[model samples]
Target: MANSKWSHTALLVIDMQNDFILDDGLMRVDGGKAIVPNVIKTVERARQHGILVIWCDGGIYGEIFWLKVVREHDPQGRDVELFRRHLYSQGKVGPTSKGSPGAELVDGLVIKESDYKLVKTRFSAFFATHLHSFLQTAGIHSLVIAGVQTPNCIRQTVFDAVALDYQPVTVIVDATAAATPDIHLANIFDMRNVGVATLTLQEWCEADA
Candidate 1:
């Protein structure tokens, strides 16, 4: 879309936290560090185009409690996803624990005072969050997403955005990552198959130009 159309678009910067991007982080995604520059550039371009910038942070205190309580209530972990149940049962404090250094955004990614910040507990930014209402209030009907680990947070958020009826959902391929290149490309292919627009940072920026 053109710059003029970006007023209705919001860029969702998902989980670009130190834990996911830093080499020594608890849950480091190796490719995440490589994409930092592209993500930074995409954010700059989005701001210049007048697109709303929304940081979808994953390590809020409430999320910790939410997961803890949910797992506690379902001690058998029946309510939790099969893959994550073991972690919850073991009482593991994930990378996004509140007030942890891992929860903070990567050093190079900027969160301007004017940018919107939404903390999410689950993979989907819209899950039990006011993101939908906030976006609606701001008249945002489209989204541009960038961040680490395409298989989880990025994919979940994009899928949720689509289910929420956000049109023209776009994911910047080079600006996002997964544990491996194959995993990243695989998720991108899935998103594309679902009608999500997958583009490189350069392509996305030029589209607004």
Candidate 2:
């Protein structure tokens, strides 16, 4: 791939944290383990093309006391999404808690010092985050996504990217996953219907050739 072809593009690696990709993680997505190799390769290809690589993980950083306070006050999870309300209410620390092992990126995926990192609390990387502003400031007009659990984070981020007018928002199919093959394909189909470019790792790597 040529650098100029993807110079304005950014690769958004969503929630490739240990919790979602490792087998023994608290919130492990079984299928996620299989995609690590593809994800790594995709990241490498993007880097070679000079595409900005942004690692977006599910982590909210703050003073320890503040986190405790928020969790206590919102014990019932009135502030969280409806689906996660029950889990949060039960005091589940969940994946990507501050300082947790699950919050780190999985093995084999490299995040060099030059790469950018964004921490998000919600499923969508854009929700309540400065991701949009950062991309805009960096002149990023397109996105290539690779990461885990297609049904939630992946889908939400892609939808938001489209809404934010990021054209040609591509999702590397084999570099992402869901709990099952059916779920993965279904979400991919939905993304494709919305004009999202759904490509396999190989196809995406060769897109600018």
> How much is the lDDT of residue 33 in candidate 2?
92
Candidate 2: stretches off by over 4 Å: 57-93
Pairs of colliding residues, candidate 1: none
TM-scores of the candidates are 0.82, 0.84
TM-score of 1: 0.82
**61-82, model 2: which lDDT tens digit per residue?**
1100000000111334455667
RMSD of 2: 6.8
Residue 126, model 1: Cα distance from true site in angstroms: 1.1
lDDT leader: 2
**Tens-digit lDDT track of model 1 for 159-190:** 99989899999999999999999999999999
TM-score of 2: 0.84
Clashing pairs in 2: none
The candidate 1 region of ten consecutive residues with least summed lDDT is 62-71
